[model samples]
Target: MTHPENPSTFDTVLVANRGEIAVRVIRSARAHGYRTVAVYSDADAGAPHVALADDAVRLGPAPAADSYLDVDAVIAAARTGGAQAIHPGYGFLAENARFARAVADAGLVFIGPTPDAIDLMGDKAAAKRRMADAGVPLLPGYQGTDQSDETLLAEADRIGLPLMVKAAAGGGGKGMRLVTDATDLRDALAAARREATSAFGDDTLILERALLHPRHVEIQVLADTHGNVVALGERDCSVQRRHQKVVEEAPSPAIDAVTRAAMQQAAVTAAADIGYVGAGTVEFLLDVERRDGDHQAFAFLEMNTRLQVEHPVTELVTGIDLVEWQLRVARGEALAFGQDDITLDGHAIEVRLYAEDPSNGYLPQTGTVEAWQPPTGAGIRVDAGIAAGQQVTAHYDPMLAKVIAHGRDRDEARRRLADALDRLVCLGVTTNRTFLARVLRHPVFAEGGATTSFLTDHDVTGVDLDPRDVAAVAGWRQLAATADAERRSPGLAGWTNATWLVDSRPLRVGADDRVVSLQATVDGIVVTVDDQRVLVTGTPDALRVEGRPVHLTVHRPGGDRLLVHLPHVDLDVSDPTGLPPGADDAAGAGVLVAPMHGAVTAVAATVGQQVEAGSQVVVMEAMKMEHVIRADVAGTLVEVVDVGDQVGVGAVVARIDPADTDG
Candidate 1:
């Protein structure tokens, strides 16, 4: 399907990215008869994408600045790999105009839109102006060149309250803040600038009027050098957490036939207006009145000049390979079909599987994945970067995979996706799999009524840690230790031969630590916690808990950690009976622990400074987001880590001495 009009295009492609997207692009490129090259950092030497590529080149160290974001390093890597085309997957430098230009200067074809299109749309302010000029409906706000703090504040007044202060240069909510009150505008502006500068290296700010309870939807468009453009349906990305999309689907339940057509035409027009080429997405903010209002119901949000993370949903629904289309377009291929030929066949849903705990404000997690088993069934596809023994580091985003499902209808797709998520067994690291299932099956979401405020508006936290799971883990420890002892010395498994000996085991699961009493017997294993005795019988893997057979998978990831998978829950519990409790424990309340591995970006506490309980002591940056570490109890600061200090998860960043009670 490719023509040779573009001299820069070639048979070899260098994927200038990492993680799942890198794996995705490499697979597509190879499948389409192109040689694939992968670039990796020191931390990702054994990554999935690198191993899958026919050739791979090292970029730099773990930090993105020294690795993926380095324009010269990427271009040099392409040159060394002898790749004629470079594919910058989503994130990192995908939307970086300078990176695109650098690829062209290296005589390499960038498998994306031109540098001009990237620059025009990458900057939110400029893209909004351009879209407005194209007669695209847009929300009223400030998108001017003036980025001064005073001027922005003045403009906020004109735009009214509940306006968004966003980093004009990037997406993914890195530098976005919602200001509902006038008093919080200044702080929001400062925070947004700081975050924007850290994430995108661009502190340019733009203000947009915030819509209440809106849905996030975007249109997928492809353009070729042959003056052909086509719209490939739409994707709904309304379910979000912290402004980042957590779930996406195609053939949005909210959009009707009339609205879909209008949105599709508008997106096609937007792409034509910018003279964009290759694959791109035009995002919009859809108000609640989807079908009633014509153009007034929706407004242009921003245009992603690169392949989106949620593109698989659109692909599944449209039965198209967007990556292939991008390659063909870059190689001067004409459109094989037009908009009239495009059609949505079915409903598709995709959930972002992240290495994070949903109960703890979705704090990003990092560790070695001891075992990973992605779900497999009809209409299910998983685009993942993780594997058994793969290390999930703190240097990058915590998203480990994308689990997608498709069916003939929305309900079938929803249930299928939920079931697939439940069956997914990824141990060693905590994830939001259960939360995702809950969101899918929730009444609002099930009825296709979820909006951007779904996460905050719903009670998605009803699932509790089953007592039997704790007991089962305790029984597993006893059985495992007994088996190991018997392996080393026959008939030396337990101290007592007449009766099973009971032992108390300290187990910790997501901030709750309990001492479980259990005994292993020839008949079964008995565990008691909270005065409840639970019986577990059967082999280690196949177990019947409390006389009821339960499906389970367990992995010992060294030390005292045990990853227990039970149905829809995967609990990474640490057996702390032999090891001493760390300083972050409740007994050491004055110690402020780093929740995750990150660099200390700010320090508010100092030695000999008086502080109160719940006061911010330090702020750490990881995965391009800032997390504040606060003191646990009232005390005077005695020890505090300075800025630029790299700390690991559970590392104490600060210590406070209890205030003198004599006073």
Candidate 2:
């Protein structure tokens, strides 16, 4: 029997973040025969990470500034818990170079790249320069130190039209702008600089050439101190909204063998150049529909020094546990396998299920997970952390779970994912289930014609909100009304009272509005309107309409409204007379309201502050994304809210004084 190489292993490790990632880290560590410690804030005392760890320590209150991002608090937790290492799972302090240095100075392994490497790659401009120096292909744009509007315009003209303005120290799509014309260059530069300054504490701006309908592809690379590097194929993250990834899939449908090899080789080269000694990703923008459709070229788009949120897709295809490798590398082990030893099989796709309203422009939603039940079946994996009754608070990211499906190929994977989504049951809050299901079933997506602009080009506004469906709901309500009339007074059925029948009844079902006319019958009950008959069977509590079983629960009073549980949607049925007037509106004014329940991280707008439409007024930290509430109309701000205050849906954060209204 042969012993494993570099058998050294730490007995205890600390997870430096909260929610699903922390829980995920703890599980992986335990599987590797290591004790785990969890650190959380007051809002996360009942979080899954705290409950699952061998030891739990509370940092501070719910606000991130006071806990997760506090270096001293995390170090103190590590000391008290007697942990030997710390794993900063993706957000919070994952990319903070200073924190990494502090961990090393405290004689604790950081479980990531060296602090020098993090500092070098953490700066976007500096990393780009390093990549260029390493003989890697870079975007044909300016990486200069000048931020003047005149110099930026000249650089844009030189780089050609339709260029991108990006922050030198930004990730997750913050401080990014797309300018299509020369007229908007100066303002765009100023805005980008301001955003960059606010987000990364650095305001330097850079220019990049924008590709039209480009596919976003990235390569996963791993390295060790033994001078070995391996590329784990590619992932297509083209489907995005507001520049944040919504769906990710491995074995990208757009790249062929030749293009795949080129990208993978480039990723390996980038890692070796940086002396990267951990898991990192090399992002690229692939052109899909050129004269040479088979010909693919890529440019370096920065490297993430830690494990990515989409790492599961790579794991599903390559059969490699990246967390295990991070542990192995920390133990000073040499590369166990060379590049040739790594193999990629099957296809995998991951969908980020967030607590946000898709119909409401994908605005983040917050509340308790009233009823959270995940689907269980073959070839489906659910990486979830929150339980059924967990509170989806405003202090963290809005993602509820990550649903991934692996199959023999892309089509099978898509089919399995769609099936899993169909069986998913989530109550109380709105989700992106129906919208993502439509994406999976979309003809273009099935054909693999998706790009970064797929969500923008595809029209998902009218899906599941049709007026025809509303009329069908009206049919269900007519049955309920007839049953109620019969149950109220069985003797009055034959008399056919005139006063009992003429009232107009309105019902609000789903997102549509409709009116139903009901008539009573002698037998059970015959419901008819517009020459269509809806047969009602069983009692009102358990209704069978048109040979379909439905569990009906009345939500409010007036006895006219009921919830019909269906496979795809929850139908709200009510009499037309009971329906509220002036509902189902999709228009609004220029007031910037809170996207979800969150504290105002920064309130930049002041009364009488002149701003153009789309200028950021407030930054709200909700879910995982930093949502910047922007101005919808060009006007002077009339109302401003203080920072560090709580806000929620329709809660006005700022209001633009009307041009016509007097002060």
Candidate 3:
């Protein structure tokens, strides 16, 4: 690890990030024979990365601003741990120029681009000017110095309607909004500014024409300190939700060899022209509607000065360890190979599994993971920092893990990824596993025809609970009750007894209620759902329903609730077996509740004030995104919560009484 050009040999590397990316860098650093230090928030003290590192440092509490985003705390940790370099793994302070400069000032290597490079590209406003000057094709929009509201409004009108207002200081879909109507421009600007200030500490924004049904394509570029830069190829990240990427694949199904070469060259030129070093991605938006045969026109989106979340696809196809190279470049090492030496083999696809519910507007979910079973196949890989009993909180990003698959071709890779998603089990919290599997297996995505509008353009509904799932839980509960009562003799396959009380159990699974009648018999426990009876014979883990074997991982988390992990979706069922038959049928949305655990950022309505349907009642911030709680019915506010109040999930934030009758 010694280099004559750079005499400072770094034996210890500190990862200044969290979640899967932190685990990712730590693994690579350890593989290269370097002692690793993991910096974590109080929330991540028991995280996988902390356990994997040679030593660990606590940054602060769970909130990122006081912990991962704190520049001084990170530098102090690097110094205390005797780390020679710090790797900001893709988020938090990854693209922060101040953090990069501080690392250099502290005599430690920042394993990314130089501070100047970060400054040039981290701010989207400045990056657009530079790229445009460099002759990169771009959308016509405003990226000016005057950030006044009047100026922005005039510029926006000039740029025309249906444009995007984005935060200049950050990426990853934060502080971004699309305005289709002229009347929504003010609200969009205000929301974008608020989110940007909270996310990136900069309210400066840039506007761009929102191309209809465009495909997001990005090129991976790696440069060494010795002026050796190479383009590793392109990845299509067209499948998205809320401007964030969901599914990504290498060697895009949309573009051909000729367009690939052109895009690759363009990325190389941009990276080389800016004197970029280390791992970075140059993003582009392909106008699918304006396609001309094999030559689809793509415009420069932005250049992320740090590694991208979807870099795994590039790595799988190119057989390159990106984190290892980031360390090497930071240590002033020259590239061992050049552009001609690089090769792309096969195909790869990756999907991010987040702790979020798909049916309910994709609201973020937070709960302890009772079971986590990642699928393992020939070419499947799981990058995660989660474990059983890990409490996923709402203070950070909702993404829990990433599942990637590699195969000989696109279809093979697609099918492999879909299968892996189906087999992956993450219990306790609601996740997008089922939604992800649906995306991979969707006809458009499988055929490589997905655009940025893929998720919204098509109706990809949330996974429904299977009737067998309801039956399994019911049977298991009955078995447990009978065994505890000691009513019968011990029998086959962990069954201790049989139940005498042959009563019907009411189960509620994700807003749907069903009555399940059970009968304990000599053969096995029988479960009846909606007049249909099925013989369920098995333990809590595996069950044979109606003579067909089904594998399920069940977790009974106290009092009447069971979290069942199936092939696609994890169902959290409310099982009330003993009490009574007539359960209260609660309905109506008279009171507005916090959809998730979060801080009330804004109080949009006042008590006694009238609000129409879809009117904003309260604004809540959680997991780095703002969720506006709106009125579901036309009513007058009877109660309201103040700003800066911390509320838990389902806590009443506001209440609205029905509007007065016309008579």
Candidate 3 TM-score to native: 0.94
Q: Write the per-residue lDDT of candidate 1 for residues 17-51, one digit (tens) a residue.
A: 99999999999999999999999999999999999
For model 2, residues 90-123, the per-residue Cα lDDT tens digits are 8788888899988877778888887778888887
Winning candidate number (lDDT) = 1
Alpha-carbon lDDT, every model: 0.87, 0.77, 0.85
Q: What TM-score would each prediction reach against the true structure?
A: 0.94, 0.85, 0.94
Model 2, 247: alpha-carbon shift in Å? 1.2
Error of 2 at 251 (Å): 0.5
User: What CA root-mean-square deviation does each model show from the true structure?
Assistant: 2.8, 5.1, 3.1
Writing each residue's lDDT as its tens digit, candidate 3 over 302-371 gives: 9999989999999999999998888878787788888788888999999999998878888899989888
Pairs of residues clashing in candidate 3:
none
The whole-model C-alpha lDDT of candidate 3 against the native structure comes to: 0.85
Better lDDT candidate (1, 2): 1
- Angstrom error of the Cα, residue 494, model 1: value is 6.8
Model 3 residue 177 CA deviation (Å) reads: 1.1
Pick out the ten consecutive residues of candidate 2 with the lowest summed lDDT. Answer: 1-10
From the highest lDDT down, the ranking of the candidates is 1, 3, 2
lDDT score at residue 69, model 3, on the 0-100 scale? 93
